[model samples]
Target: MTTGRYLAAGLLAATALPSAASAGVTVTGVSGDPGFLTGRIIYTPGGIGGNAGTTSADLSIGRMKFTGFDTATAAALAFNTYCIDIFNYVQNGTFDLQTFTLGNAVKEEQLKALLSNTAGLIGGAATLGGKKDISAAIQLAVWEIVNESGNNGYSLSGGLFQVSATHGSAATNARALAQGYLNSLGGWSAQPGFNFSMLSAVSPANNQRQILFAPVPEPGTWALLIAGFGAVGGAMRRRTRTRLAYA
Candidate 1:
């Protein structure tokens, strides 16, 4: 079978299996894709209270595409994800996918709000530049929500989370864009069809935790699918019974 076919078959099989505490996954860079943005970010030293005393470094942001095999069955699985932990870096190697919990209720709620509301801004950008801007902005917002302490509310220009001005207009504009999105969270309700799962690396404790976004079937839609499957199964059962009787 072709490599793509093998990957598809493996993914299908992997999804059928029960969820494991940690699945081995590998992450690599994605090039030539508008969905993934490449840009430099510089955080001010001691700017975020939670990440205090850490020196700033030039970092890139955007959606990460990863491909790996299931630990139990060796089935191939691939997906796009975003970083939630800015303190750690992503290495190109196998990492175990572990369930992540924010522990802080406020941070968890805010992150959910950001993911539910701003997903369209990233997905629906009309141009590559626009998409990159939104993608960077989302990453900034995520970092602020996850890492910032002392809770001055989420903001890129001020508060516990702040971006440095040395990285030029790209970094400046991204922070501003991110702040705009954070401001819109007030009175915003969680949107349907948006589901999020957090993944962390088990072996290397320092690897960044990532978030996966997926579209979920609505309750009504799932009911229809279940009914359709039942009808097909009944027809097959009836066919088998008739064939046995005739024989």
Candidate 2:
């Protein structure tokens, strides 16, 4: 019986351990004068016991001039090859983040193509190809657009750009993606071609200031813990009762 109890306790403890896949997303690329920058933007999901994750990777771009189209929407509409979707919604729009999986391969491909085209047309060389796994898609979306220029930041042709992605709590994979990029860059900083922000708001969920990684413990976890303690208490109480009876 003691061995069985110990086994249960061990299992419960194992469940509480953080997984390698849940480490969160990170961005490592170049920006301003110093160029090289790496940071994490933490994220927390809503609802009781929801999962959390963070974006540690940071990038910045500035003074970008475009010639292909005026706005991201125009570029999308005009160039179907890239297939850019435009909207103004903050929570549930085309870019709204519902989960961390973001298992939309088609959308990912579209994003890559669009960014590549934008870079080429803007006369900016593709120093680093922006590629992210399914887990880091939301962070991928943020890096695709944001303010970074000292005087002028990353805004759409005519208006501010806002978009988000959603995924399940089980799919926190930002760390893996960031490591992939960093490996590709040979541990070098300052791409010398792009600009970056000062670790400001990276996600609409206010990811710039905190670490949004890892899910909350389930109610079952607490229940199991309480039940385990109750068992131990019951065992002690029975021993006391027997001693009193003997006396």
Evaluated with lDDT, which candidate comes out highest?
A: 1
TM-score result, candidate 2 = 0.18
Candidate 1, residues 1-247: lDDT per residue as tens digits? 1110000000000122113544555543221123433233334544211244643433444443444555656665555445554443343334554444577776666766776677566557787777667766766666666656743356665654555555633366666787887777676556776544555555445444554454464332210000000000000012212100000
Q: Per-prediction TM-score, please?
A: 0.66, 0.18
Angstrom error at residue 49, model 2: 22
Q: How well is each residue in 1-247 modelled by candidate 2, as lDDT tens digits?
A: 2111000000011122112233221221101111111222221221101112321212211111101221222221111011011111011001111122113443333323323222222122233222222212223233322211221232212223211212222123433432333233322232222211111112333211111122133531210000010011001112212100000
Checking candidate 1 for backbone clashes, the offending pairs are none
Off-target runs (Cα >4 Å) in candidate 2 are: 1-138, 141-170, 173-175, 186-247
